[model samples]
Target: MTQDTLNILHLGLGSFHRAHQAMYLNRLIEAGETGWQLAGGNLRPDMADTIAALERQHGEYTLETVTPAGERSYERIRSIRRIVPWDAELAGLIALGAEPSTRILSFTVTEAGYYLDERNELDLRYADLASDLAGTSRSTIYGALAVILAERRRRNAGPVTLLSCDNLRANGERFRHGFLAFLRQRGESELLHWVEANTTSPCSMVDRITPRPTPDVAERVKAATGWDDGAAVMGERFTQWVIEDRFCNGRPAWEEVGAEMVASVHPYEEAKIRILNASHSCIAWAGTLVGYRYIHEGALDPEIRRMAHDYVTDDVIPCLTPSPLDLSAYRDTVLDRFSNPHIRDTNQRVAADGFAKIPGFIAPTIRERLADGHGANSVALLPALFFAFLERWHRGELPFEYQDQGMDPDLAHGFFHAADPLLAFCQDLTLWGPLAGDRQLAHAIFGAYARVQHFLGRSPA
Candidate 1:
């Protein structure tokens, strides 16, 4: 640690960050790339207890990983050198972002946190987003980054990279646009000018099945590593990060530590988002409807597995053909990752954000297929699965409490209690975009919904 050390100030301090991005930095440091380090924190107090525990341990935590074969391994992750405490004002995070030494400021906020509409514009209907637009708080990503970049500009901090490690397709480009739109709406022309010249948000695709830490994870860590680590996290052995390599400031030697620094992240992201993420939602929704609690159960079930397999094999792979990677192999690998029982990825976790997942993960394939004059029958099952899952939540029958950032309770209830719930769902512009009112889309989804009802042993109403 010296004046020469550079930093990556990360925004989200969740399990995915702890097990994925932070681990990459740790590997680089272990390989003797000592010039770069991580200073991680959160924008909100959602994980105050985890942050406090991380600070107590000086930002060191144990990561437990398991393979599909049931073999387990543990590694001590010491990449996060500083754990910035959460504050309502985000004062400490803003100061770190304004530092020229912080070459890259990355974030892992969930996909729903962006609050972008189908048109890629900022959706101010959200209370947090509206409050941020009114300058009442710095809670959302755009709001937080606006103030950070403004302060950095006032202090004359040099150019830095704004990296996004989320599941959104073309995440970096999408975020850059949404962020600039936020500034334009805020009437910060001078600050926007500085941001346009000073920051680069390169698209990146990150993958790792990092499950929410259960009490068993900590007990296992204590048994295996002899450390009482409250900050311990667990994930699948497979991990990946493909970046667009457009950093404005200098970056770490990440390529030396198994990360792919590509000229473009388009192909990689398309495969990951469509095949892995979309299928993940499909399984989660289908699994939850059929009384399954874990993702592995759905991935292992013959009928549920076929639903996901058919969606990728029938709809997605066709659209993504002529790809750099083997689409079929990639699809199989993703399903195998989901079937790892030790990860215990919950249906509740994966099934929580359908409102966001529909537009982001599932709808693109439907749009492409419909544009090519093909019916979206296979892809329709995904939204149908979601509809059945939503019905359970509406009836207060879900085994666990559902959490959706984009869902409106009254709106969802209206959908279920409407004359035709499926039609009402299809007409939600936020979920389907231009395809919202298409008769073909409606027909396909209705048929799929009936099929879902039969699968769940209930007759369609």
Candidate 2:
């Protein structure tokens, strides 16, 4: 394929995609590969400026990989052929999706973009669905996809693949469910049928710790390349992407470039979500409570590190399905990654969207443990940390501003004020859900929070 004809549209032009997917694509291009180039779509309005900067720079940016020993930077990232702002460029994105040359439509739109509800199901209640239903010029990734799929159905645009690179478990299935639900909600069952029959959503697990670049890192990149890179990304040296080989419109031989396209991505996704991600959140909340800034600082604290290690090995791993690989070794590597001194991954970054993330990353294991006749006494510490954070939120002790998502500030405050009554409150089957209402688990979580209060010396007034 010629340069102009090569097409791949990536949603969510975030740092992680820059370091992971874009980096992998760069490797492919350097090895003389063809028929693959990226066109990024930034969903957020503020990101339009970054997209313009990258486009002006000919889609080149710096990728800095920070290891414990030192840092390694890559300057040329020519795989990205164009940048399209999601709102202003919706027509372009839809056109690319409808193009015969466009085979892969990949997304790293984070967990929120999937519009998942409390049960981790497809959340059609999202406002974007209503907008799309009304035939408005709404420009959500989901909205754009709905429009593109509708056009594809009309044109008989052949089969296409949708690859989800988010942290959601069974990501492809989740995407398919969301897409079909959107179509059905819009009364477009014909389009839904076409999508169900022709489209493929491949499950994938992508791992990397790419933090938004700091000003110092930005200055370094500018000095090295003589170009002002506002969108430079900083990450750890480790990167992995495991995908299931289920694609409708064909895919690049990504497996040749160190991507593992397995027959099943369940094991890989489960392993990463339960182990790496769960541990990361555990450290994020617990470490932040103890006044640690970066993950490395928390890892260096013996008490925090031991707590994280114990939580992973004793509680989290026991509830998981047995893996073919050495999980212990994997745990060790994760700990090393967290302890990478050069990477300043902040607690607040990982700790964001806890309400949405914990249900997937932490709650599944909690449920599994409870089902297996195992008391959640050890696991209770995780929720206790969350409760402590909630208590902090109630007291306005948190340094950064956070948008409250569906969580009632009044309810959170009441929980903190009635710490003595928390055990009974937690027993409220509605708020805690069925899992937390289990007497044994509730008692354990209550006890753990009591301990936390004792350590902190009095609840927030």
Candidate 3:
């Protein structure tokens, strides 16, 4: 064990980070590896209680894992050595990020947080991105990182790896594009040059069913481990992290701890996004419409499960043929993971980002199938389900609040008020991109929407 410790300044300190990436680092440490540590914080001021609790424990927390048969286990995760407290000015986060020892800067800001348009450019329509570009705010990931990188450059912190663990396809490349655009728009030409020469953003695909922590997580931890751990997190027993090996400075030997370090993460990411993520959302939206509270309930429901299975088998598998993975087996495993009753992943959590998911996770399959003159009937059902889910949200019929960061409330509400709500939804450029008003796309969606209506025991719109 060396005295010099390398640091990863993780941007988001949420449950996913605790259960997935930090857990991998903890595994390395547990296996007697040293000189690699994680310092975690968040750009947003949310998760106040969790942050405070972690601070009290000096960044230690418990992680509870459960299997399908309801077997549970707990481990004390001590990888996060520092919990930088939240501040309006982000002074603490910047300080840590600029440190010479912080060799890697990683983030899980969620899919919508990127704010990239269909053209893969940073969309200024988002006020947060605009504010960050105009130097008024640092709430967005690009903004927060801009100041941190500027400070790092000032102190000559040398090179660092900017790893994005988000669900975006080519996440590292997309983030680099947006980050460079943010710098360009902010007129930081010198800093942009420095960044181009000094940083590496490797695309990574992270999979784990880390649900939002409930009170029961802490209770279970106390019962099993005899600890009153307020900051404990829980996830399913399955976990995977696949990263492209393109670090500029240095990185942990993650591959030694069950993390897949690959030459290209494209195939892995595409499969996960189209198969697991899109299907997860499909189950969530369909389950919510049919009054299922948890993801496992929907995954176990024959009808909803078939909807996901058929989508992958019909639309996605064709697009992803000649790939490294066994698509059929992957699909079944994903469904089985979703069906783990012990995880208790919520409908609201998975179903929150319909607007974003449509474009990011589900649209490519529809676009590809249509281009090849193949039927997108199965994949179309996902958007149809989201449309029904959105209508419920519009009518205040949802069992819980629908949280969509990428949603424009005015535009979404206007859909229900339009003369033909379904057609209005079909023409959404943000959702469908170039295929927004395509007749074939609309026809498939309309047909699928009717099936959705029939499934819900309502007359077709």
Lowest lDDT 10-mer window, candidate 2?
424-433
Candidate 3: pairs in clash = none
The RMSD of every model to the true structure, in order and in angstroms, is 1.7, 3.0, 1.9
TM-score of 3: 0.98
Model 3 has an lDDT value of 0.93
lDDT (Cα, tens digit) per residue for candidate 2, span 163-281: 88899889899878877776777788788888888889989999999776788778877777776787788889888999899988777778888999899988778878888887887
**Candidate 1 lDDT, 1-461, residue by residue in tens:** 35588999999999999999999999999999889999988888888788889999999999999999999999999999999988889999999889879889899999988998888878888999989988999999999999888889999989999999988888999999999999999999999999899899999999999989999999999999899998999999999999989999999989998999999999989889999999999999998888889999999988889999999999999999889999999999999999998899999999888899999999999999988988788999999999988888989999999999988888988998889898999999889888898898999899999899889884321
lDDT of 3 by residue, 1-461 (tens): 12388999999999999999999999999999987999989898999999999999999999999999999989899999999998877999999888888899999999999998777888888998888888988999999999999999999988989999988999999999999998999999999999999999999999999999999999989988888997999999999999999999889999999999999999999999999999999999999898889999999998899999999999999999989999999999999999999899999999987888999999999999999989999999999999999999999999999999889999999999999999999999889889898999999999999899889994321
Overall lDDT per candidate, in order of appearance: 0.91, 0.74, 0.93
On the 0 to 100 scale, the lDDT of residue 29 in model 1 is 98
Query: After superposition, which runs of candidate 3 have C-alpha atoms over 4 Å from their true positions?
Result: 1-3, 458-461
TM-scores of all candidate predictions against the true structure: 0.98, 0.91, 0.98
